[model samples]
Target: MGNFFFVRDYCSISVLPGASLTIGNNVFFNNYSSINCLDNILIGDNSIFGEGVKLYDHNHKYGFNPEFSIDKTDFKTSPIVIGKNCWIGSNTVILKGVNIGDNCVIGAGCVIHKSIPPNTIIKNGQNLIFESLQK
Candidate 1:
């Protein structure tokens, strides 16, 4: 109640002992928003996670090991970094090794696997025309 507040509902947050989930100032996590940080997951200040947004830093490797494969992971984790002033839409899945820059808008229901630069808008499977909005 004093200053920082974490409002969660129907969400399972399992951070390993000594593991960290850093929530910046004025950050809000809505209902059904789950953050599974096995390593280090940093959510920037003033960033909001909408309903049903899932962020996982770990993936399961299913193949036998000789060299390595991205598709096969035995529950390994890297790190998730989200910059400040970012708006994450609902039902968005932010995968491992993703560094989202500041002031970026992520469209709803999009699976982000790579890093997004600052002030960038990502929209998948939609035809959008970028016309001048001002007269």
Candidate 2:
């Protein structure tokens, strides 16, 4: 965690053993936000996570096997990176191996599983749309 990092009401963060979570300066998490990091997660300076934003650096690993059962400790993990000045909107879910660049805006209720470049605006989460950030 960096200087001036703050989490508002009900924000939760979990870092598993041997995992790395690095939060930069002036980062903020709003109400009901959560981060489950099993591998690595980095939040750059001046980033803000909106209400109910959820970030995960790992996903449950599963395969179709007759004798296989759900294993709570089995997971596939990667790093999640949010660059500086980014605003992740309410109810957004950022999955593993996602790298969001600087000055980006992700709209509400979006599920992000891919990398986003700098100066981008993501909107209309139900289907999803993208625009270059103006100015």
Candidate 3:
């Protein structure tokens, strides 16, 4: 962490043992944001995040191993990298292994599971098909 601009109240950043959370200079994290770093999470300089944003660097592994079948803590981890000057919108969920490039704008309520290129503007739901379940 290097000269973070501000971290609002009720925001939680948890780094487990042997894991790492790296935040660069002038970064601003809004209220109700959470970052769970089970491996490595690197946020670059001049980045700003909106409210209720969540970032996770690990997820549960779905393989059926008998001994650890009932264990809900069995997880696989990867790193999440957010590049410089990015703006992440409210209620966004950035999952494992997502590398967001510089100067990007991610819209609200987006679940980012893949990498985004530099200087991109990503918005929500242009192809949303809301089918009724009234069969």
The parts of candidate 3 lying over 4 Å away from their true place are 66-70, 126-135
Q: What is the per-residue lDDT of model 1 for residues 9-46, given as tens digits with 9 covering 90 to 100?
A: 88667797666777787777778988888888888877
lDDT at position 84, candidate 1: 83
- TM-score for each of the candidates: 0.79, 0.89, 0.88
TM-score of 2: 0.89
What do the candidate models score in CA lDDT, each in turn? 0.82, 0.94, 0.94
Please tell me which predicted candidate would have the highest TM-score against the true structure: 2
| Candidate 1 vs candidate 3, TM-score winner | 3
Each prediction's number of clashing residue pairs: 4, 0, 0
Candidate 2 C-alpha lDDT tens digits along 23-44: 9999999999999999999999
Residue pairs with colliding backbones in model 2 are: none
Worst 10 residues of 1 by lDDT: 1-10
Cα error, residue 46 of model 3, in Å, equals 0.4
* Deviation of model 1 at 93, angstroms: 0.5
